[model samples]
Target chain A: MMIKRLTNKLLMGIIIFHILALSLLPPFTFTEVKAAADSPGFIIQADWVVGKNMTPSIVFTETSGSDKTPMLRVHYEEAVIYGMKLTKQFSTPSGPVSLTLKADGPVRMSGMTVDTSSLSFKGACLRATENIPDAGLEDVTMVVHYMNAGGSNIEQLSLQTVDGNQGPAKPKKTQILVDLALLPYTQALKEVEKISSGKKPLVCDEPVADEGDVKPGEPKASIPDELSREDLVPGEEVIEDRVGKVTDPVTKVIDPATGVIEPVTGITDPITDPVKDIVKPVEKVIKPVTKPVKKVLKPVTKPVKKIVKPVTKPVKEVVKPVEEKLKPVTAPVKHALSESCKRVKDTKGKITKDLGLDLIDQALKEGKTLPELCKGDASLTRALEDFEDGLTDILGLDFIFKALGQDEEAKLKRMKETLKNQKDNFIISL
Target chain B: MEEREQEVQVRSGFSKKAFWTSLASGFLLLGLLLVSFGISGVACAVPIAGVGDFYVKFDQLEGTGYTFYPKLGETSSSDSSPQGTNLIKDVTIKNLQLYKDFKVGGDTIRVLITASKPVRITGLHHDAGLIQANAKFQNLTLKENNSSNWQKQFEQTSSKITLENAKLKTHYLFQETINMAGMKLTVEKIK
Candidate 1:
């Protein structure tokens, strides 16, 4: 009975210990419990696994590291892989040419086995290695390391097997139908095709028939030796007569040089002659009345003049010295003010030159009116306005015009003239 | 006779108490074992680490509505064609195999892949990469620019592009929109 009790305690202790040990052991030891299917699959071990639009059915192999959960299956449906590189050395006529192909596109795969210590989805590390449901990721970029040797055109490429053997004895025939627009270098290809097919040259040397030339056996209508206004229209002669009569007087009145209208040379003579005859009778009647009034005013003016002359002379004498005394003080002040204004102008000139504002000013000086320079250029107009405002703040409205060696009123007048000319041209041109 | 009966009763009572204790302990052990199995099952669900170098191969590959940009720039003198965005309507590959090689001690460990069916992808956009392939075109057209300032001398287009017994290699292959049929994998070691 003592031995049975001892054995029971010992067995319990052993069972507890075994359970603890089994629990402590890594879970990978039990992977045999869930056997993977025997089917066609792929295994890829990349230093870095980065992709997107991945709906992959992936299985993870056991690995050692802090990351306990490794991605087992990913159903990367439409995944974009970035920076995938492959290189091969080929024997060419020149020498050995190393060719490297880099690709980035949507990849489709089936039965793929991915092995990586680090696997991330959308840049975040997967915490667990389980069947990742549809991981529809977009824009997964990766970095690949490789070397580039030199240039090898795709046209120069030749078939080679995995064992690096040359072209096959009997090449398989394949046909690809492609749209012309989808292909690159379309125009170049068309030209080559044209040349190879011996098509007609784009530029032909054949002489073209003139539209005015009359062909053999074709009837030609006779043309009149001269064109007549009366033949073209029945009332054209009368219209010409009326038009000439109206234009003759207008031409005589308008001065060509000034583009201004002047009265016809003899137009005012008849009116002036009639006015002179009427004025002669009226003048005779008014003469006697005017003579009496003038005699009455002459006596009153003499006395007043004598009294005012003495007072004005004394006032003028007193003001002369005061004016002379103030000249010395005011002259230097005016000179200093002018000098400061000139200095400000000079500083502004420098700033304008640095800012390229001087180019506009130069163009203005070159006879480009403000309107002409600012036409079709809103930014230039705004810049000029801003510059004008800056000058107005520092000096005054007329300062910029003065600095340009022109009067503000003259500049405005010129601008108006330019605008008027432009408007007139716009109307006439249409 | 009375003393012997009392001793027998005490011994029976002790045995019954010991039996109950043993039975309780056995139940506790079973519960602990179940809890441990549950924990391990959860752990196993986590991703296993991967081993090896990157390698992939396909028996046949086909793509539709393909477009590629050479990005040769605007000048005629520039010969360097950089990678740009490329597009395809859909793509399919048959008998696909991929392998990742690893060095364990002196031997190389890799995943061996058998034959597989077709993998399909739709609406693929390729951003950048270089590709080398043997190709031939039918009804090809070539246009030339003779301008002194032009960097590229000629441009080409074709009604059809046929690649037979052609080997295509790529560097930096990044893509999108993929689907694969069956998958089978096995690991192998080589010295």
Candidate 2:
């Protein structure tokens, strides 16, 4: 009896709890679909099947009890009919006149096409028209035809309402105009076919050739105006070029008159000329002192010395200029100029042969070339000066400094100012 | 004399038993009356009542897109935190009080609107009873002295309170957003 009473109480509590819960639960409802075009006019819509070449007919309807009369007017700019025929007869309930229509080849209808398989109906009449008061169609089906391959067709889409309700031509025709846009697509496809036949068509299945193998004999996609000799002897020149790049070759001379020191910079390339604007004054002063001393002193006594010097050492391996030295000196200063053109000769030895102008300078300064001290030292000075001039002229200090990770002084000042402004902004925020 | 004594003892026994039984029955009857009184008080006292979908929204009145349904039954009472005494009855909240665990800058914010009052929120180490008017995290306290008994009705059965124009208070582990739609809140005895 006690257990029964307890069970009844528990059941009552559960029932009360469930009843409260059921009353408290909320319900939900969803709204229905309604879409309207932003523009006002006749709307032509169709459902098209993908991968299948078929068109659905357009149907127009006038809503009931609407104040305005609905009509469809077709203004055809052009029309083409193919592979079909048309039949027409004027029929009157009071009296009838018989009209005969003939069969044609493939019917092609332009401006619009009404495929009997695709079209539901094609004609135009307002709801006000008593003949077909309920008929919603707006355009007439005048003629039909079909076309063979490579057929000519062109047309424009327009409308003429019986009500003269025309103003600016409405552009809501975009829905129907899309199917007619095939005119441009057909033209473009023809152009693509022509292009493919004339040029190498892109092949999807062919494996891509390695860029390295396809490189040779392939016309260079980009040809520089100048070809680098470094390309010919890349291995031989790599080291000397690397050393020349690192070592400071130019000795900058400050003209006391200008109060500006022209810092000697190294030439990026041994062949490129030095910057001219910065080194012009220094070059003008140094050239007169160096060139004449080389020419006059070299010829007055060394013609005989140059002739005998190569012979003194039999193992010295005289190449071509052994015996012809005096004749060349006598030939003119031009011959001596070419003979002493060690810069050019060294370049010819290998693309990278270092002329070692620095070593030559050390040899002259150490008095190691005591026998030909004048010639060796003079050649060294000329080579060193030329290198200095080349560096000064080719590599602008301002430009190089920027490239080597240094900021412009003005930019640094601006950055400082910006930092100060940010500090002030932070204080204002606080 | 023995027989006379026996009769007196028997009369005394009967009287004693009768008195004891009467007293016991009387006490039981009093207890039943008290229990009935309590049950009727609970049945007729009326659970806190207010708007069915009562909510105080902060900032934008309508656009916060937050709805708080108070589940007063699920309240966990704690004496430590200021907003520990919550009167909310039965409901779960999304966005209005509880938020997804997320990090903003270098701080982690986790907030939930339990049935606990903002002033009695336990585990929160906030000095002020009320945090910011629109505290984004944790249970926040409404101001005292309010005419509308939303807090009262909420404590009894549950109702969805849409709170707007609230501020947030920073607590030890989290911050609490308080509904300050009005200036005052009052305490009421809920069913």
Candidate 3:
């Protein structure tokens, strides 16, 4: 009787636990990937089968599945998607799926990270090639071996919801792949414009059911609810902030020189003027020190120049003619300065490259947001363009310095000053 | 004595029955609750695609291309260093889309929204002077079948890197371009 009573108590605890677990489990969410042009937003390929060509177009796939995987594991999710397609199994929104493909042709697969410039791959064979041949067969499946291949942050993806019932675009010899898109190009673009700000495309198999529990009006798929009490529907403002990306006003800084806002400074200030903000304070500190120092130097230098000039004048005239006999300089620096303004080479190795394009491409392929990619593009266009405009001025100064027979060190100093001056007073005529 | 013992036995039996009946009812209650929770859990599973479909498209290249660096720091890596190779290509650029914001080392350079097929990017790197990238092209067939619509590709490295804007003739390219569009780039600080 005691044993029976104990058993009854144990059963009661188990029953209570089961009910509580069921209530707390979160809802099952399916993240859909759809290309607006070729495919509508997210889609489901229910009951997909291997095509008649004996090759599969889309292997096994899940609508809402894991896009994250450990580095050592085959992007297990991508692996399953491709593996299932390779094995020819139908995948569901929440069903377990896997796929494996061997290179029958020159195929490339790469793992993408949130940092576009990052070369790390979280799963599978990390491979990529710039070149790929035209399709020899119609139904050969091209696998997406990337976790973020759908470009979650960029809101870009090509998802097809094809199942067994849906057949291939009728195979043709000269079939152009242009019309295979789900929506017409222009029409799809209109759709993207309308939704670009408000909606976020659930990444490739990335479930975004911020709404944890499935309410009556919510999606009705048989997903195990892993309900957590704290999970709340994300506010629309957050989504809009990420998607709409309203350009916050460009911050402006006043230029001390002109008492007006200068094109933003220090982004790539050649002069490295991120300290422009502290320039006033620094000037204040230096003014006191420099004022007395300059006063002393000025009196000393004047006496020294007066004494040296008379003595040097007689010798300089003798040296002047000798220097004049030197080789003729090509396109006197003045002519070169003006002529080369339209065409000139900056110092052989002074220009700075933004690396923006390369990093952006990598970022897009890796699927990072614009702001993230922006970090890679450190450009000071206003500064650079102004510097370019000041090229003539710098070159003219170079010639003057050379004509004065200044030493190389003095020439370099003047060049630096010229650049600073350019930044202060550059006005592009053209 | 026998009559008293008979009364005690009848009371004990009644007490045991009451205990068993209450226990059975408790178990029955738990079982019903378990079923109800399980059913509700199943009902809450939401199909993601059922959230409704949006078939919108982007007509413009909506972003700043990249941050332009006019000057590198005294010890910038891009200065006086031979970056990656610059393999030039002579292919007409059609339907190019710039990003909303471009950066020095990261940003989208080549986005073929509705342009020719198989556009190849050879190398795109930043230098101390300005931003430069190289693209390659093969036998490009224009959509309008006008093969001779455009001239040779844009190719120039070093000082000859063209600063002025130029145009490329297109065959069946549709829509106007917006490089400086709605997107504005924000540069808070630079290294």
Please tell me which model should have the higher DockQ, number 1 or number 3. Answer: 1
Ranked candidates, highest TM-score first? 1, 3, 2
DockQ each candidate and list the results.
0.04, 0.01, 0.01
Error of 1 at A376 (Å): 34
Segments of candidate 1 deviating more than 4 angstroms: A1-430, B1-55, B70-86, B103-105, B112-115, B125-175
What is residue B47's positional error in candidate 2, in angstroms?
99
How well is each residue in B1-191 modelled by candidate 1, as lDDT tens digits?
A: 99999988977764656765885576467445434533342212111112211344565555543333223211122223232333444556567565556564577877554336565655544323322333433222222222222212222222223332333322223334444445455667766
Q: What is the TM-score of chain A alone in each candidate?
A: 0.15, 0.13, 0.18
Clashes of each: 83, 92, 65
Q: Give the least accurate 10-residue stretch of model 1 chain B, judged by summed lDDT.
A: B43-52
| Candidate 3: CAPRI quality band | incorrect
TM-score of each: 0.21, 0.10, 0.16
The Cα error of candidate 2 at residue A63, in Å, is 15
Tell me, what's the RMSD of every candidate?
A: 39.6, 43.7, 38.6
Largest DockQ belongs to which candidate?
A: 1
lDDT for every model?
0.34, 0.27, 0.26
**lDDT tens digits, residues A1-430, model 2?**
9999999999999999999998786532111111111112222222210111212222221211111211222212122332222221111222221112121222222223121101212222111101221222312232111111111121111111111122222222222223333335456445434433443211111122322222222222232224333354545442222222346656888666856778989867566776667544443443444444444434465444444344464575556766644544444342242223454334432211122333234334554421232244464444444543332222112222232254434322322222221212121110
- Reference-based lDDT, residue A119, model 1: 25
Tens digit of per-residue lDDT, candidate 3, span B1-191: 99999988987764656765884586467445434533342212111111111111222221111111111111122222211112221112223332111242443222122222222221122222111122111111111011111111111111112111222211111112112112211223232
Off by over 4 Å in 2: A1-83, A113-430, B1-191
